[model samples]
Structure formats: C-alpha cells, structure tokens
Target chain A: MSAPRPVYDPSWDRANPNEVRRSIRERGYTGYTAGLAPGFVQANICILPKDWAEDFLLFCQRNPKPCPLLTRSDVGDPSLPALSDNIDIRTDVPRYQIFRNGEFTEEVTDIRSHWRDDLVTFAFGCSFSFEEALQDDGIPLRFLANNNVAGVYVSTMPTEAAGPFEAPLIVTMRSFTPQNAIRAIQITSRFPNVHGAPVHIGDPAQIGVDLAKRYQNVGDPTVGEGEIPVFWACGLTPQFAVMKAKPPFCITHAPSSMLVTDLRNSSLAVM
Target chain B: MSAPRPVYDPSWDRANPNEVRRSIRERGYTGYTAGLAPGFVQANICILPKDWAEDFLLFCQRNPKPCPLLTRSDVGDPSLPALSDNIDIRTDVPRYQIFRNGEFTEEVTDIRSHWRDDLVTFAFGCSFSFEEALQDDGIPLRFLANNNVAGVYVSTMPTEAAGPFEAPLIVTMRSFTPQNAIRAIQITSRFPNVHGAPVHIGDPAQIGVDLAKRYQNVGDPTVGEGEIPVFWACGLTPQFAVMKAKPPFCITHAPSSMLVTDLRNSSLAVM
Candidate 1:
C-alpha cells in the first residue's frame, strides 16, 4: 500500500479550512492544521456528553481567555450553522482523539461510529487568529517563522470548576524582545476572543513553567537571553481540565489539528 | 533671614500653579516650581522680540516633541488668556533666565521691567505631564524618588532652520527596566502635546550622548544598570535653538522652574 501525504506539505497550506474539513470527512485525512486556513479562525474542538457539557460551559464562562466560545452545537445536533453553514461537528475535523473513562484511546480520522445522541459540541477561539494579527502589525514572531505555534503545556494552576468539569490550567508561551513584546500585547489586545494580552510578561517560573523545560514534555522551553517569555491562556487549557474531569465519553481534535471555520480572523477583533 | 528658604521642597507641593504664578508675579515666591501643582500641566516659557518670534515659531513647528506649543501670545502681549484666566506670562513663572544676544544673563523673579511691547511669548509642554501619566499607570519612576527629572542634554542631530532660529536637538533621558520602559512608551504615546512617546530607547551612545560623561555641562545624567535609558524631546530644545539664533533679546523659564497652568494633565490624553 502507498504511504499517505504529510499535512505540512505545500498543498495543504493552500487548502481552505472548509475544504480541508470536507476531505477529512470523506477521505479520512488525519493530520495537523497548524498552517491551514490562512486568515480564518481555527477552533479547539470539544464534544462532550450532555452530562458533562453544562459544567464545561460554565468553566469556559469563568475563564474566557483560554476558552472563548465561538459557537456551540445543541446536544446530539452534530451541526453548527452559525460557524459555517455546512459544518458537521461529528466528522468535519481532520482527526479526533477519543477519551474513554477519562483516558486517551486510539486516534481516528472519523468518529461517526462512536457518535451519541447526547454529545454536545463546542468550538473555541484559538491563538492562530491573533498570531495573524501580530505578524500584520510588523512584529516578528520567531516560532511562526519556523512554522510553529508558541509552546504549549499544562501549568500547575487550577481552573474554575463547574460541577464535574475541572482541571489544571494549560498555557502557551511566546518569546519576544521587550519592544516587540509590547507591540504584540497591543495587537493581541484587540482580539480578546483569542486569548487577549499576555497573562504574564516576564520570568517563566512565576507561572510555574520551567523555561528550560517548556511544555517541556510536549514542546520546547529554551528561551534566548534578553527575550521575555509571554504566556497566554491556551485552548488546550480546557482540554487539560477535561482530562481531569474525564466523563464516560469525550472527544478532541488531535493536538494541533483543528476545525477551520468560515469566519475570518479579522472578524474576531474587538476594536 | 530665616537662612533663606531652600529653593524647592514638597512643602510647596499643594500650591496651585496659578496661585504659584500669581505669587511669583508679585515677587512673593521666587523659587523653582518643581513638584508643585502635582497633577497639572507645567509649561516652559519663552519670550522673543517680534523679529525673532516668527523663526522661533517655525523652529518649534519643525521639532514639536521638543517644543510642543500649548499657547502663544500675540506680539507685544504678555497675557495668555487662552491657557489661563489670570495669566501674565511676564510675571507668572517663579523665575526667569534672561538671554541677551544669545548669552545667559541674571535670573529674575519677574520680567515686567525687561518685557517690551515688541516681544511675543511661547509656551511649550514639559515632561512633567507625561511623567505623571507613567506614575498613574503604576510604573514606578525612580528619578522622582530621587527628587530629579530625567537628565537633560544636547544631541548632535540638527534642528530644521526657520529664519535665524536653528540648533542641534536637546533631549532628556530616564532609565527604566525594559518591561517598565515599554509600559512607559504606551502610556506616554497618548499625549502628543507633552513630548509624546520617546525619541529613542536602549543604548544612549547610538543617539550621540556619551553615557559616561552625559550632559553635565547643562545638568546631571542619571541611569542605572539593567535599565534602558529612554530619551524624549526636551522643552529646552527650542531654547537651545532660540539662543543660537540670538535676536536682540529672548527669555525662558529658569532650569527646574516652570509656569503652572490650570489645565490638568488628564486634559492632554488623546485616547
């Protein structure tokens, strides 16, 4: 059998988010969506059983920067007409990670066979929108230059709980010169729905992340001298909480793989 | 004599700028206005013969940050009805520095005897307003704690010439931690009338001031390690240019002595 094409290849970069979602639903494309959907908002996907949905919704309400909700589907509805007319929450994302009894199981290209009538879907604002805003402001982003998002991982800080939904906060770190960091703050501040201005601006230890060990288990933590590390509440923050509040059934887009929406990122700017 | 009261003390702190000006005009108080009228805007006063006024005005236009004009009196007029109701520029400021043929003469408490019908008055914004803004933003100002304004000096950069009025730029430097310096930039950026933002940030030598010697020829320079020395256009900049032009006569506020206005510092915020 022939091996499948890689997601980072040029062809995928040019593909629109809706088109990518269509292919995932039809062709079983299980790959990352980091550089996809150029100027559109990409979401952190979460599908929960009705039993756990209300609490997670409340958890997002209490901590908006990490989980700004773009749209949420009605229980067992499988569709979000507001985000995209044709979006199917059940199988539109490129890949899904199944969590059974609060633990990770095998990743799958399609989740149709596992769908339940009580599953409710939530789409959240992600950093890609504001990352686009930063570049347009003439501020250089080192990680994006190498085609990467800022580092991400769980922090020891716990999140506000709603009933059964509770977990530690997860964050993403971006490093920039003092001047550029300020510009980044102003630019990102305009996009509050996408994790507005940095939560912390200086030393990493204050936020409980080892600069030398960043998402250390998941990503790079080495920051250069004179460069300040800015931490933003991350989309993965909700996932970490979800993992802690593991219900009988939960699903998420595979890490770095998201559901691209038809909405443009500029539409997210508060100003 | 009660050993002659010191030139400046916070005891003068609560005094209103207009009250101070009225007292100085009457020769009742003849000292510096530093730290008086805490939240009010202070102005650097300049008086020039009508012949030289046009060029000096143009010079101010060319270098606005250094010579931001708050108000200008018509030729031969000392009353600035626009800036304040009971204002008489000739006798308002606590002290005045007399310049004859571009050379410093005696400092006087009142200029009424020296004032002439052919002279015009120029009021420029000083750093006191923006400094107040930084403090309000929760950015600690170290120099204020040490009872000093930012350092003063002349730079090699030449000012645009209008008539005979022309000279190199003069600036003020204040050191701040890189992070605080960035906060200072954003806060000050709102007030263009008060030397908005900074001309240059980081290494001082790049702008031609030898950090080691500074401009002690005019005033002392204070900078600390791990602190970026941010420079702003100084109100004295126009004074330097005006002196070089050397009409028959000119006058300016004495160093550290300023004319207080009824206008609050908050009145200058553009945002």
Candidate 2:
C-alpha cells in the first residue's frame, strides 16, 4: 500500500501503447514499459536474421515452457500484422538490446536505423500476463511489492534442444502461503502462452538452485514462513540459448522493457 | 506397483453406477467401491433423523469445502432419484457404520433393520471424483498407487457453524513432485464439489499438523523425496462434527466404502 501507485488512463490517453510508442518514437519518453498498457499483453521481443530464424523457431517449439512464442513475423517484415495492426517491430518497443555474434553490444531506444531486410521478429509471451493475473486474484507476489524483479535462478533441468540452442532452464521464483500458492498455480496454469503453471515448487535444491545464495548474476529469492517457492520458466531462457547459438545478428527487448501488444491479457488463456 | 489393485472392470463392464450398485446389492460384489464406478461420481452417505436433517443441511451449506452436498433424499426414501433411479439407501453401500448417540456401535452389511420413517439421507461429493480427474490428467497420487486411503489429518482450520455441527477441518494429504502437484491443483480446481483444488500445500506444520507425527487416529503419510504435500478438505469433517455433537442416531459408509452414483465426475465440474 505504500508503493507508488501506477498511473492509469481510462481513455486512449498517455498510458496507451500507441501513445506511449509515439512518445518513445519522438524521444519524449524512454523508460521501462512495466506498468504501461496494464491490461494488454506485453511481449519479449527477439529479432533474428532469416537464416537463424528457423533454428530459433525450432528451439522455441522444443522448449515451449521457457520460450512461449506468441507470433512470428515473415522474413524482412518490420510490421507484425498478427500481433497488432500498427506494430512496427523497429520502433514499438520502449528500448531494444542489440547483439552481434552472440555478444551483448549496446542498448538503443529505437532500432529503425539498424533495421534490415531478412530480419524475423518474434514476440514471446512474458510473465507480466500471469503476474497481473496473480495480483488480480489477490495473491501477493513479493518482488512486485518490493518493486524489483521476481527472483531469477538457473535450474539443472535442461531445456529441450534444437541444434546448438540448449541450456539449463532459467526460472523466476516467488514464495507464497500454501493456499495462495495453490491459487497461483491454478491462475497461471490457465495462461500457458505466458509460461503457464510452474516448472517446480518447494525445495530449490531439487531443481539445482542454491537457495542460500542465488546465481548472483540474476535474481535471488527470499522464502518466507508458511510459504513455498514456486518457479516458472523465465523469458531469459531464450536469451541464454540465443547467446549460445550466436546467430551473426540478433535483437531483443532491453531488460524489463517489452513490446506492448493489442491483445488483452485474458485473450491468452487456453481455457 | 506392488500394491493390491482395487477391483475394476477394465472394459467398462462397471460403467454405470446402477449396474455397479445392482452388483453390490445382489451380493455379486462386496469389495470397496474405490474403482467400481470409474467415471461416475461416488458420494459419502450421512443418514439422520428428520429432526436432525435441517441442521445438518445448514451445516453442509455453511461448510461446503468439507461437505459439498451433491443431493438429499426425501424423508425415509430408499431411492435418491437424482443420483440413481434404483439406489437403495439401506443396501447400496458395501458396508455401513451405525452410530447411536455419536458412539461407535456396530458395523452392518445393510441398515434395513435400523431404517426409520423419520430418517433422511444426505449425499455429499467424495474426493474420488477429483482424484480420478487428477489421474486422468496424468497426475499420480502416490497414496492411491500404494493401495491406501489418503493421509487424513485434522486441520486447525474451523468450519462455519450451523447448530451443533462445529468442528476442526479434516483434510486428506497427497504428496506430489513439485511439478505434478501444480498440475493437480489445476485439474481439481475445476470441480468445486469434490473439495475443490486443495485446502493447503507445502509445509504441513503451517496447518497445525506436526510433520513428524501421524494424526491422532489416522494412517501414516508416505511423503517421498522432492515431493510437496497437498491437503484437501476431507468428507470426514462432517463425521467428526456429528461425533462431537452426539446426535441421537447416525449412519455413514464404512471408511473407504462409498455410495456409487449415476453422475459422472466430469458433470460436476463448474467450468
């Protein structure tokens, strides 16, 4: 209750993605898109050259839990008609991370100047949909309350592979009272496109996670009393595989800044 | 796998509850009803005098988590037309425990000799329906595989009161690998009548049950490695309440013995 209240606009006002993108496009706004477009789905963007697209698609297919693909663009297509009519992959996201030869290069506000033909845009569902779902159900997630990312941990469970795109699954952990934990499972399970259910719960060590200390490179958890740690496949999983597979050129959403989609959060539910 | 398999007609020879009930009534079958009614719903039986029925109904209405009432029969009616056309209150159940002033009196194959014109029957959903739902979803409940009843524990949670029916919640525990436990939560959640999802999960001590100790009067839990214990509201709640209240007369199915019904468990799913 003491946290800064998220600002919401009832009409297609300042909070709308289209309007937010216009602000970002003009360099008027360049910040994390966490609370913007609150009820709509925000996607993790991964743009790769056409040659590496097929391999990544194969990887996603093999590891749906970690890389739940929402939509894929045709080759050289900067516009993602399937995701939103007005979506321009080059400029829609608040910020973009440019990677070259599998290494972190630089972060940019817009990618239109770096855009090219033979580029394939991917929009993978993120944890935001399920996080919103959990909050709506009155299940308190600790990180959101703390205004920090949920605890991220590397697990021993290996992801299914498509050629070189193989890595241990990366997961986000959240501890909850057993009752709320059950409700969290039931709620998140309905949205499989957004990592769905959970990959593991209870003892972190069972999944090869070091509970006393996190991976340190990523998030660490604080497991509380009467609560159990629940894990969900993380979107970072694709980044790990993509880095290992190292296509000549790749683009992804800047950490915590995602591409807002026209699709409603409720629309992602498989049930 | 080494556990004794409960009687089941694999080809669905025991598809209908009526057929199964007929077999039981004719002495063609006298085993437990655990696997007999396969897809159909099975219920917990509670027969009380007309004077006690109203309070009991209110108790059930107040404590739906434990006593999810499926149907109630008219005074002294042997047939619960809603559950099955030929269901006889006196002989359908394989065995019955008759209670006098809430004291354990004796067990009988049939209660015809004890039947009273003033007696009314209350049928409540049993966990068998949701357990079958869980198994259908490929979630293995180890207790079932071990050929034992679920681990029953008395919880600190209290049911809402109606007249003299007030007691601590009784829950049946099922342990699952963290992954399957989440799946179990999703599958059973859709069927609120069968106790609905779980009342508690993770550490048992939170619910007032000391993990190292077995319940005061129930079976031992067989929790194994990398598994989390999940607890569901048990039908035994009402029986405990009745015993505490010391009703003038009562009759219930012998533990592990249930009354088979014509309704499929799927039909009770709210979603």
Candidate 3:
C-alpha cells in the first residue's frame, strides 16, 4: 500500500504551536515560520557534533547579547523537552541548512539522515521573539509593513572570543522617532533572552555601519524623516561565528526558517 | 542676649539627612546642599500662597516629567512629614529665593520671617537624587568632577500648559560615551519621582540647544570626541513654569540650595 499524500492546510497559520510543528515534522509545511504560532517562542537552531558543542556553548556565554543561549539538549539527545513536550530536533524545524567545514553544503526538509549519537543541539532565542514584544508595546517595526523591516550590517565591534569562535558583531537596524526608540529600549530590555535592549543607538558610523550600505537588504533601508535608527544584536551573529569556527559538521535552520516552540514569548521576559 | 553660635563641623558632610537639615536650619551651615547627606533625597522647594496652589498643582500634573511632585504640604502647614520627621519647610532648606509676581525679590537664609498662614509647600524630587543613583552605577557625571557637571538649556519644546503656568522646557545636558548614555537612561528610568529617563538624546540642535550658549553653565560645554550629549528634564523646568505663571507671591530654594530629606535615594527606585 502507498503512503497517503501530505496535505497543506491554510488554517495552520492560526493553529497552535504544536500543530504547526506537527505539520513541519510530517512534511506538510516547509515554509518560513515568521508569523506562525504568534505569541509563542521561535528559536534559532544550531546543531554541532559533540566535540565542538562545548566551545560553541562557551562562545554564546561570552557574547550573550548576540547569541543568547536559551537551552541545549543533552549530548547525543535529539529532544529538547525543556522547550516543548514533543520536540524532535531532527524533524521539527521547517527547513535546515547543512554546513561542512564553514561552507554551505545543502538544505534539507529533515535531518534524520544527519542525526547521530555524537551530536548536540543548541537553541538560542531569536530576535523575532522581541519584535512581538516591541509591537505589543505600540512600537512600530517597519519590516512588518514593507516585508523588509531591517537593514543588516556587520559592525566593527568585535565579539568576545571563546575557544576558536570569533567574528564581527552583526546588527539589525530599525528606525523610529526618538520617543518610540526609548520605549523600544525599555520594552526589549524586559526580554534579555531575546537580544535584550539595544547594543548601540545613534551614529551608525560609530559602529562602522554605513546606512546606505547593507550586507543584506531584507527590509526597507530608509530612515524616515525625524526618525532615528536603533540597532539590536541579531541572531545571525552566531551563524557568522559558526562559519568562522568552521566546525567539521553543523546544522542550522535556513535563514527565516525557525523552530516554533510551545513556549510563549512573554514567558521569556526577565522581569 | 545674643543667641549661641552653632558649631561648624566639617564632619557634617557625612552626617545623616536630618542632621544636615538641622545644620542648615540653625544657621550652622548655609551653603549648597550638594555632597551633603550623600545618600539622602534632596528636594526642590516651591512655596505658593493657598490661592495659587491649586493652579500650580494642576501644572505639576500636566508636566510630570519636569515637575515630579514628591510631596505637598496642606495649606498653612509648614511641616512636610511625608518627606521626613521634624520637617519644617520654612527652616529645612538652606536658602530661599523670594519671588513677587514672577520677579525675583530677594534671597534669605531662612523663610520663617516670610512664612505665612496661607502658604502651601510643594516639594519636587531633584535631579541630584538620580545623580547619586547614576554615580552608584558607575556612570560618571562630568559636572561632579569639575564642579560643572551640567549645562542648563531652555529647549524649544513647550510644557503642557495648565492654568497660567507654561514655559519652554528647561533641560540639563550631560555628555557621555554612547555606551554609558544608554546605561544612564536605564538607571534614571528607575526613579520616576526624579526626572526619570531623559527627554532627549543626541543632536542638541534638534531641541534648539547650542551647547556653547547655555542658559546657565554649571559644567564644561564641550561634547568630547566619541561622546554624545544626553539631556534630562531639569527641576529648573518647574521654576521656569512658575516664573511664567506669575503668581502674586512664591518662594523657591535658591540655586543649588536644596532641602535635604530623610528619604534615602535608593528608596525612590521604582524597580
């Protein structure tokens, strides 16, 4: 007998986090998880062989603002029960990017073939979690409207190195009126696990960022009249460190494809 | 017979807040209250006749960022028990500025001779309180080092008008490295009774400020290399509002001559 075909359900957008993960695990949903399971935590997933896990963990600890480590799975364990009840690291994320010695190898729907007894999974809080917080506080995020809410820049600021991991800090910029910028700082400050407060504000040039020059243009780059740019530590920072570390084997969620978990975003607030 | 002369002891600087008030009240100490009662709350005093009290109260409510009213004495009452024990508003402050119909009339060592049955005392939290908090957190105030830690500027931003009270907001500028500036905002935000967070940061021109031309210069005007100017709503703002309001009679503490209270500065932290 042939296996039944997986059906994509539009209602999944409004479904619970568990349902969203179920669809992704079953191969029914393979798209970016940006707005899915709103209010729940979406994580940036990074997997490495057991030999390189300790150094990567130390890297995150040393450079917490950019790589806020939320939880890590037991060595050789594929489950992150601390984050959710039914997480299977090999199949939960919608898409995975495979890297071999710092070079992009391929993308895959699931990592069952890559799962092994010598692997460790590390999950870090993503900036997407704090965007919900900023929005809830009435701070407007431009990328929400124009589909490009931020301009990515590699700051001259160097990350504190741990073991072999070292890289320039990557920041994502969002412009707001000075008034709203203060509110943004206050709101994001409550969620340190998700980047926590701005790393720097005002004078992008001080951080070696040229507003007109963006490393990746995923959002509108315009700083509106009377609006000042506020920059936050981006989750891409660890991926950069990983690239420079050149681990023998690594797995991460494809850019924009995150691990949607049952944990609520508000639960991440330190306050 | 002549009254006994009060002893002058240099150790009064380390004395308790109430002792400092006693020294000032007894004429043993009649100098600026800065660096005295180091950890206590120092207040900005505004005494108005009962007829003008209501309007001034409304003015404070309308412009809380600049006029964070901490306590108010009942009409005809000279005591501010809310701020300390044995508190007599007429004698606690070191010096008084008598204003008649919005014009400066005279300065006095004590207000007992000027105290009246119709007088109402309003004590607002002073920036001196938050300066302590900032210093405790290791954010340096330049004015503290050179005895010119701040520059007072009259900004183009207008206060919310209440009754006859309305004037351009008065801001105090303090320069810091961009990093320490963010820390200053976070630390000051904890004491809303004080000015709270800064009203404006960066680009003094945006707020109609010319650093070289301060309304009153108490500190260096230089914005050093790699340093940005941060402006906080000054206690002087309410004094400016009172000046414009033009009440029939009002009394305020002389510049830098403040009321030292028993309340600890740390007690004012909201978080």
Candidate 4:
C-alpha cells in the first residue's frame, strides 16, 4: 500500500455535498467521510462491470433490506445525477477498494486510472442517515459516542442467490435498552431505503452470533447491563456477496469512506 | 348470582351496533357479546358516581396504554352520543358487574334500578379493535381461533396513581413468532386509541410473568416452541385500580360483555 494520505480537510468541515465532492475530486480530501457534509445522505458505493450489473441488480432487488438501491448509473456512466449533480463515480468517494477474481487487489484514493467504459455504478443506502434520525430523536447510540460503527456478524442464515452472488447474511448489532430498542425500531422503520428497522433483537445466539466475536471488530459489542442487542441488515452484505461470487472485477468504497450525496436524510423517510 | 341470562338474540347475529343495542336495551340479550357486531367498536364499560369520575379520568389520562378512554358520558346522562346515536349507557352493555365498597356484589343485565342521578360512565378502547386490524393484516391470532381472549398477567410494575386509584399494571399476553411479533408491533402502532404496540416482548419473566399461571385463566398462554410471548397493557388495569380504590358504588361490563358502539374500528387508526 502507498503511504497513508490525509482523509479530511478542516476547511470542508461544514461543506455541502457539492463542496465535499469538489475537494474529493481535486484529490484534497481522501480519508474516511463519516461526519463530512452532515444532514445529507451518504451511500455505500459498488461499481460492477456491465456484464455483472444485471445479476447484481437482481440480487439487490431480491434482498432490499441489505442492498437498498438508492440509484444506479447507466452503463459506462460515471455520474449519479439522481444523488448529486456532479457525483463522479470514480472520484467523489474518498477511498475505493478494488478486487479481481474475488481477491483484494489494492486501495486507491481515485479510481480515474482504473475507470472502464463498461463500469456501472450502483449506490446503496447506508445506515448513517437513519442513525442521524435516531440521534435527532434523542436516541443515544453508544457506538457513535465511542467513535465506532456497529459491530458486524455473519449469520448462518443464507441470502437468496442470484447467479453466483450468494453468501451468509451479514448483520450489524447495536445495543439499547428495551424501551429505546422499541423506539429505535419505530424510528428506523420510517426510512426503508436505509436498511429499515432491525432483522433480529434480544438474543444474539438465536441469530448464530457469539457476542464476544464480531466479523470485523468495527464497534463495541459489550451489550451493557439492561441493554439488548438489536441487529440490522448491514451494507457490507453486498460486498460479501461479491467476494463469494468471484466476479472478474468489482469495486466498492473502503470501510467508513462513503459517497456523500446531495439528498437530504429527511427526504429518505417513507412516512 | 342469578342464573345466566341469554345475552344474544339470534336475530341480532351479524347486526350493527345500534341493532345489537336495541335488543340489549329491551333486556332480551344478557350474555357475552364477543364476535358480535364485527366491524364496530366494543368498549369496556366503567361507571362511577360523579364524585369519583375526576380521579378516574386523571388515572386513565396518565395511563393511556391501559385505560385508553374511547369516550366518557356527561354526568347523570344515560346517552353516550360520542360513541353512538340514540344509545343509553345504562342499558346498552350486555351485562353489568355491580361493586359495593370496591367488592363485587352481583351481576345484572341492566343498571336502571341501581342508577343514581350523579352517575358517570366511561368507555375505554378495547384490544378487539387492534386485534381486528392484526387479523385483517393476515396475522394469525391463536387465542382468537380458540374462542378466548389473550392471557392476562399482573406485572410487578406500579402504575401512576390518581386520588383513590393505585395498583399494579396489568398486561395481556399473545404469542407470535419473531417475524410476526415485529409485524404486530408495526400494525398496532397505528391505533394509539386502542393500546398501540406492545409494552414488552421475548421473556415473560423480564416483566414478572410466569406464563404457567395467568391472572384470570382467560386464554391459552402456552407459547409454541419458536413463538415468543408479547405483552400489551390491558384495559383491565383500571379495574384493578378500582378494586384498590373501594368506591361506594361502581358498575363495569361483565367479562366479554362489552358495550358495542356505532364507531367503526377503522376510524380509530391515527395514521
């Protein structure tokens, strides 16, 4: 890997999605984009070649909770006009992960050098939007306070297969008191595009998870006293499917590095 | 005390609330009224002397989940115009339970002979409204199929009290698979007037329920192997408070002998 590059610029602290994209496209901002352009929607980026886009789209359609498609770019197109006016699929995202034959190839700040005419970009809604909604409603999320994402677990449950894209269901768990858990469910149910509510709650073992171990060690899974763990369909689920499918080529946003969009989080609420 | 008086007339089968009330008013129907007047709202009745009405009203307001007031009659007025047209509260309900000094005295088909000029009547939203919604959404309610109501339990949690009313919160339990339990919460959340959503789910012991021993033996509480017990605040909660208050005189609907009203159950959905 090349030397680590700064991912954030303080000048873009309160920048809007367009402003953030300008900095990312100019190669000034290349780090994780978790808090940048707050109140706007940030999406998980997945760019599959046109040959594989059909199967991936079908896969996403079948498993909407994990892969809720926000917008899909036409073949050979680099811009997602629906999400942002100038969202260049190759440069708007801070960091991108490249894979070849289901194997990790390398990470790059800009995919301009690797851009292909056959590339088709698909943006899926991420949990950040709903998490912001929860916090706005006075629901405290422990992981956010601890500067971590939700802990992920690969459940034994299988996802419906489309072509070779099949893998165990991936889940992310957050702990909350029973009362807050109910409130969280109600709040998240409003934003169906962003995973929408929880897939499982209460017993972790019931979903084939051991509380002590998480797939990526992304967040704290302590599940403190009087708190129950609620699991949501994770955005990483599609990435897992790509790895299992062993497509000739695949591209995705690196962990915590997302494509900030012009869409307001509030607009995503179905209610 | 008195040998059972027939509560339903065959002619009243599939009748509207007004039709059913007409037969009930003539003292020809005096049995349980469940499964009658299918689409209309049926309420749990509570009648108190004017002096005790204020405190009971406050209690119901403070504990809305349990004592959701559908409508309360004006003092000494036999008509509940808000619930139905040309209806008389004193004679509308199928059977009335008479209490003296907070102790059950007897059951009567009508309360005209015992009515005092200062009497006040309160009608609370019952689970039947939301249960109908649940069944309409294709959620199978096992207890309903068995001709029973939900199992009842008195939780150790104390309810907010008013002047002379203070008692433990009473809950009703229903069993559903995890998937259906989540759907149940969503469906019921729409009808706030009729106990919305569930207060607790999963382990019954977490809420002080043994499952093996229901409070009144009202229904089958046996949770199937994969089903979990979900508990909702019961309308009977206020009756428990009345039992503690020991008012000079009180009248309530006999079990399953509700006051059928002209209000359509669909009208209660806040959404």
Instruction: Report the number of the highest-DockQ candidate.
Output: 2
Per lDDT, the best of the predicted structures is 4
Q: What tens-digit string does per-residue lDDT give for candidate 4 at B50-167?
A: 9999999999999999999999999999889889877888888878999999999999888899988899999999999999999999998988888778999998766899999987
Show pairs that collide, candidate 4: A7-A31, B6-B30, B7-B30, B7-B31
Task: Quote the B-chain TM-score, candidate 1.
Answer: 0.91
Q: TM-score winner between 2 and 4, please give it.
A: 4
> What is the interface RMSD, in angstroms, for predicted model 4?
1.8
lDDT by residue (B64-112, candidate 2, tens digit) is 9899999999998878988877889898887889888999898887889
* Candidate 4 local lDDT, A121-157, one digit each (tens): 9999999999999999998888898778888899876
Model 1: lDDT of residue B152 = 77
Encode model 1's per-residue lDDT on A80-183: one tens digit a residue: 88788988877888778899888988787788899989999999998889988888887777777775567876666667778876766788888776557656
Q: What ranges in model 2 sit over 4 Å off?
A: A1-12, A215-217, B1-16, B28-30, B211-217
Clashing residue pairs found in predicted model 2? none
TM-score of 4: 0.94
Write one digit per residue (lDDT tens) for candidate 1, span B77-180.
Answer: 88887678888887787778888898988787788899889999998888889988888888887767876667776777666778877777788887776557
Query: How would the docking of model 1 be graded?
Result: incorrect
Per-residue alpha-carbon lDDT of candidate 2 for residues A149-243, written as tens digits (9 for 90 to 100): 78888899999888768888999898898888888888898999999999988888899988665654555478886678889999989999999
lDDT of 3: 0.85
Fraction of the true interface contacts (Cα pairs closer than 8 Å across chains) found in each model: 0.00, 0.89, 0.20, 0.09
Ranking by TM-score: 3, 4, 2, 1
